[model samples]
Target: MKKHVAWHIVRACLLPAVLFSSRALADCAQDFARDNAYKPHAGAHRMHERKLPLSLLDGQWVPTLKQEIINTISEVVPPNATRITSDGLFGPIGLVVIGDRGWIRANGDAAWEPLNAAESKEILDGAFTSYLSFNRMSDLSCTRAEHNGRPARVYHYKMPSELQIGSHSEITAYFDDQTGLPVHVEVEDGNPRQRAKSTVSIAFDSAIAIQPPETAGQTPRAGNADPSGRRKSLYKHPPGEAL
Candidate 1:
């Protein structure tokens, strides 16, 4: 379990070290996001899937590489990043967070529930993998650069060969210049057919407080997120079909 105080540490640049997929992985990226109708211009596919320089991180693969990246994230990504968000092939995946706990609105239900510490750690992985759990991979990347108008540090690691040839997951984060609260967190799902990006830049502190429900019934109490516990698309149509 990530330390409960991990929430306090969240306000730092560590907002979104990573990004999601849903359903089975017969074809991970392709099938995982098929239920989502969003697709980028087929022309933009190449650019969207473009691999930024791997030199983003400082060193080559070492035995302690994963741990080293973890340490750097604990030091860098958080102190500067303000908000954490994810984007699927569709759009902003409905993940809301207040302090350390976050909620995923599943099954078209309006109600929201708290995410367990382990669950949150998986998403923010000190790297990115939206809905998927964080597993160590070889040849990860890290760097600090200005993306868009916002200045942020970026981190990403290689996806498995099976996911796709150019396939990888990455995120750029920004911090609220004034309060130092997280202002923006974004993830890039590298598929051109069904491009996905999730962002979280709104509702923080007193702006939008997400408290636990008074009654236990209102809270789904989903621990570690069992396969059966995940939320399916609200209305349900086949993958690639329009909502």
Candidate 2:
């Protein structure tokens, strides 16, 4: 899948932020200052993301759109694999990638069709870099909070307008208090044409591994998926090829 598409998928699974008291805000700001100084190691992580549709009502955004038709599910396995399922005209459609090779299939379809060379290249080029992008953030606000009964730090910030999906966005991120690693993220953006909300849940050191799907529910054609059909292939395109 392309980077933009993968990014959209990654945006799917997050929770909206809630306000906290002034005392909690002070502690959160202190935590942000300290945590932002050190980079924590988040090795071989996975994510489940979902995007929700929104509508405008009385000058506010609400999740009142056709929920059934406006949902997307995404799974990520860094540094080179992602799978996304979204509502399609017919039904749910699925796209998956492991390294340079990938597959696609509609809901209820038995066979997983292989992606073309062009798409495979996009998948390889669009591999995820990091779960969080904390560099050069602006208009930062934070609060101490609890997520699932555990101590949490929630940050509300504005990214550079040029870097946001729309002209502006409201971004909220939840981090583990002790680890300083991200746990969930929510991004809501609006423009004259459309409005969107997305959430993502991050899991560090996930044991679930992404593998290439079998074509037609049958075994992979031997030697086509890397030298061995079972192992992952971290294939890189030759330089100067079409991206």
Candidate 1: residue 112 lDDT (0-100): 46
Off by over 4 Å in 2: 1-45, 57-65, 78-80, 88-90, 104-128, 133-143, 159-166, 192-194, 216-243
Candidate 1 backbone clash number: 25
Per-residue lDDT for 105-160 in model 2, tens only? 64423246677666755544433533444434556787789887889888887543
> Could you tell me which 10 consecutive residues in candidate 1 have the lowest summed lDDT?
41-50
Estimate the TM-score for candidate 1. Answer: 0.31
User: Which model scores highest in lDDT?
Assistant: 2
Cα lDDT over the full model 1: 0.32
Model 2 per-residue lDDT at 210: 69
* Top-scoring candidate (TM-score): 2
lDDT of each residue in 164-197, candidate 1, tens digit only: 4667655543433333333344555434333333
lDDT of 2 at 99: 70
**Model 2, residue pairs in steric clash:** 12-50, 12-51, 12-199, 13-49, 13-50, 13-199, 13-200, 14-199, 14-200
